[model samples]
Target: MALSGELWADLSAERRIFCSVLLFSWTVYLWEAFLAHRQRRVYRTTTHVPQELGQIMDSETFEKSRLYQLDKSTFSFWSGLYSEVEGTMILLCGGIPFLWKLSGQISGHAGFGQEYEIVQSLVFLLLATLFSALTGLPWSLYNTFVIEEKHGFNQQTLGFFFKDAIKKFVVTQCILLPVTSLLLYIIKIGGDYFFIYAWLFTLVVSLVLVTIYADYIAPLFDKFIPLPEGELKQQIETMAKSIDFPLTKVYVVEGSKRSSHSNAYFYGFFKNKRIVLFDTLLEDYSSLNKEQTEGEDGENEETKSKTKNKKQGCKNEEVLAVLGHELGHWKLGHTVKNIIISQVLSFCLTVLSRRFEFQADAFAKELGKAKDLYSALIKLNKDNLGFPVSDWIFSMWHYSHPPLLERLQALKDAKQE
Candidate 1:
């Protein structure tokens, strides 16, 4: 008999293990949050900036950074705790099975039988997604309107928020309905080797999404205006040429419409590849605005290159420094490698990704502008109000990006090479 159907005494053993795993995960996250909170407190009280990062920000900016982290961590901790509790409820309350049963009933009422793969799968996914969305709405609202707004990062108005939400719903349904239906059909057709076929199908879909995401999907949210003829654009193209990184049209997105953080990134593959910069980043870094402490975070946050602005004049060299780091990924083939790793079923593959990050940094350093790249990194860390994770275990096992300190050290080490 299935564990769920077993006698209470027998089921208790398995339930204990599941509960323990859940509890352990929650505890680790809470502990990490605590460490981050403590780290921020230290930053707030101390005037000492790490020798490497001091060039990027002053004591005042450092305090500002610490304050941002405090707000972020506080929100992260409480929201995480709520998520854990909600997840526990969902599991123990038999909510998933109930949702499944409800989906079947709804589909059947529509003249689709329970055994119809496409209908059954589509209905379940649709309803389940709706349920997830409704449950998550309150937290999303608080994050956007309350926490983000408090941190000066929220650019969304209520009208824009609702519009984004509706668009997301429509887009998700458009993608999910057909995708889930096809996957269900494949499952019905493929028996023993279903997993192999499913993996291949997923790989194809992932590749397609990546190709279109920056070009097509992103434009759905924000406008992309071509970077005008300027020193910055010339430098960007020149750097891409030097690295032999595929360059298409360089377009700057109006990312400030959503958030006050700035970024540069390269997206797509082959002929489709393009370099994109957030307009806020260009404005912040181009003229080297000593007064502007923030930039638009941009739509694609997947790139690394943290910086905090210091009182300096605009140097096209600084923007080029950021571009060098982005091109490093394209030149080194880490982007496609990352896509492959993400799609595979592996436990340790993710940890191995830290190597790819370092390698890309090395590539950036090799392209010259090592000092500018270093400066950009410092600004990014300050701008993002980021700190190094003190917990070594969590840093190694969980962090997707290398900690800021680690990257700074990496840049320092790269210069030696």
Candidate 2:
């Protein structure tokens, strides 16, 4: 009877509810992937580029970008399906809860009494994490080696990849083990106010992590080379001052070491905020700016003059305009707003999250950067997540930023107020 009871308890109706939720979530994910594909299809079918966004890319590069988007969406759909299925199978087979129970057993063997809820919680979290990582390792490998390489973006050697994987695992465990344990411990000790205090704890941790990430954590992955004194730096500063945006020096991260993807972003709070541009972004900028071969063997005065005089295809004004858009996020307090919404109203994330993209674009335009920003976007078009996709349904759930067309239209219609 005891054995039967144990089996019966294991197969309780609650498990069914949990499995159902898992399946539903996966189905939603697959549907989102389908919508991404649909968006790509629509983009392919549409020939006419709107005047506002026409300069984003030339016809040829735009076609290549569309194909790339299609490829990515196709891969994501299949991989997403496999992942969902794997998760569902694990749930249906009682793997996660079994793992949880085993974690408790192991913790007990270590003399962490079962009564110690914190130890049990921490053990379960770690074991569960390890299990998931092991299961997902193959897919991660395939993604980096096959899919990304096929797209000409995989730059890490096998040695670097393994080292990175190890570092990430160690760093994540170090951080999450303590944070998650504390949250769970709070639940045990706080009683009725557990959730309220947990919420507050999350907010503080989020803010702290944001402030320190560029300093403490990011150095593990890439080098942050300081941008030297030049027109680019000077213009960026000028633009910041013109808008009363407190300025700091900019950095150029060695982004091309891992992927050809490009980006620029801001970090720090208030006066300490820093702008970071990607090496790939500067690759475009190099066409307009003189290249300095300071440490090169073939350097001569004539070569230096030629490198300096070489016409970098991008303009300084346009680059500053891009910086202006990034600055808009800080000015509008979008980052803080996002943190609050995510911690408090996570359910409303889909709706409330994407507006800030538009707001920042508008802010950039308001800073008298409209035309130059347009020019910059044109140069950086293929480097972004843009494609011609008619993806209304796909966008409903997954889009955390406005579509390129929408962004371009917003910029066109924006005015200083």
Candidate 3:
């Protein structure tokens, strides 16, 4: 007891904190691995469509979803293990402080000197992010090329992928470096309430980014065009006007250029609100239709025929139903509520997020969109090859929205009522 006490006493606060952080990180990782194991078990054993899923999913689709999820789970396991081991090694080897000193030296060589702590800090941040990107690159490439390509989700050619990646890195650095510099400067000059100032600064930055992302940053990568005049546009405008949603413009982003996944969202504050829809979400306008008409490069008739048979997107009414759900978010103040709660009460976030989704679903139901939304949900899930089933614990930890079946049930109940 005396020897143990003496040893514990000899451990400095910094050493204790360092060891504690490592212990906590590993503990979290192990917990995640265990959760993943349970989910993977479900993926492996649930080979056929369950009685509950029979109506919504066919045997072929279910099997494809099962295999896709299994592959994703396997990939996640290896990537997660690699990340955990890398983090542990970095901490054990004092990688952070070592990199900090190296960054200082680099800045000094560039005539910035140690007194320019901001410059050294920027150098350190850049080096850190670059290191992270480099280390994760192989896993990313494997996911995009091997896993996603095999599953028919990957759309970018190797050249396009690399070009896009480089563009993203450059744009990210341009934004990150300046923002971090400003943040560090604020901290240095803020004195006692640096935390408060930092929080406010981040809040402002987030709002600004949300407001400008679709307009400025997003268009830098993907193409965005105004939703052309049509029946769909007219109906959407009518729906918006009915709810006083402050909808200003609608855009159809060519998201199919990267992936076949469909999505839609509204952004901006007050009257400047704009809705952006992935081109993949519109049955009529979807680029997936092209696959039916023409063969891709190097694709033979057999491959082209297989691709052509794969349908994507939703009907017009279903698209309107999706818009109804999205508009519900705006009308119900879910977005603003979430932002505030996320910044303040983060612990309750996951549960509250799920609740918010349900509320939005209910609002859509109230808009007489229950049946359309239900069908839309199933179609979207099938198109994305999303695994409808989830482990309870995993769902609790990770899913912000309720599972497909649960939402469908809720919508059905609402419709019946």
Candidate 4:
């Protein structure tokens, strides 16, 4: 028997919807890639004063460069807006058809009605997620490889990136699939009351996951070792003791193996708490004080000059200042406040993220001198491409971090006391 004309038309419509969504996503991705390429070109071609200038010049030049890049990369704005519109359209397009098909199949059966609906909903959700991931993976790869590499910021090898992706995918499925199945099962059997119980269960599970993330999950991907014995470590321990922070273990992470960025953080609760510094910071500090020859034999006068020119590359005082700032986040209750604020803001617009970032900045100031923090911030700012400070609202909604200028200003204001 031949298929009916109406059925053929419906199939065509579905196909067209899928094609349209894919086409729009790809177009937006391509435009973003092109803009990123242009921004990199502009950054590389632009000339600026040398970094050895006085602190004010260094900060100003860094801010200007960042603003320039921000203006050139308006692609983020366009892509972000398009992403929301495209995502909603694709969901509606795929979901409505799935619902109709499921409804029709269930109506034809007697005892299978409730079971079919539950099964179909689960299947539909899985299919939708899979489709989105598959469609989006190419753009993620492009960003990591083409865009990041062009700017010399990409530290991940293709193998590492893929391995990370696989691990994340497995973890997500392991956690999500069982919970989804259970929820659907409850909905099938418990009818209306299942939703209340499901909500409570989900909230409890989310809290547990958040608690375990820093302690249990983070170490699975990155190795953390106790910060080795050194003057800096002793100083940190002394500071912790002064604050009655119960000094136990200090650790350094192997972040430099992946990227040149330097950072420190405090993790865990109570006695389980520990501080971690990046090994890159350690290496940078060691090299700065020495003749610049370490594990690599290619190190020469040129290497030493380049290393010296790198803004605030691994200075112990700067590291201490940065770590102090992070400690401030904990000491001033910014960390706990941030957690509560995040939960409250999860359903709202992204303004809370920016505000919390400023609060952390203020907290950092309470722990360290504003000048030291400002200097570290200036160095970090100069080392990377700057985005526009005026695009706070756009960036707050799209990006995870606050502008460096905003952070600097917050520190400056806090220093007023």
Q: Which has the greatest TM-score? A: 3
In candidate 3, which residue pairs clash?
none
Query: Order the candidates by lDDT, highest first — what do you get?
Result: 3, 2, 1, 4
TM-score of each: 0.82, 0.83, 0.95, 0.67
Q: Candidate 4: lDDT of 321? A: 69
Q: How do the residues 237-319 of candidate 4 rate in per-residue lDDT, one tens digit apiece? A: 87777666755678877554345555667776666668878765553543333434444544242222123334334456667
Whole-model lDDT for model 3 versus the true structure? 0.88
**Considering lDDT, which of the candidate structures 1 and 4 is the better prediction for this target?**
1
State how far residue 226 of model 4 sits from its true place (Å).
2.5
TM-score, ranked from best to worst = 3, 2, 1, 4
lDDT of each: 0.70, 0.72, 0.88, 0.61
lDDT for predicted candidate 1 compared with the true structure: 0.70
**Pick by lDDT: which candidate is best?**
3
> Which ten residues in a row are the worst by lDDT in model 1?
299-308
Better of 2 and 3 by lDDT: 3
1-417 per-residue lDDT for model 2 (tens digits): 999678757876986678569868877886766777677677667655555546555776676666667667677767788888887788779887798789889999999887887888888888877877887778788887776666555656666677777888889899999999888888778998899999889888888899889878987887787888888998888877877777676888766556556678888876787888877677544311444444354322212122222232346677777788888887888877777678655436766667877778788888888877766676676554357445687676677776666676667655333
The worst-scoring run of ten residues by lDDT in candidate 2 lies at: 299-308
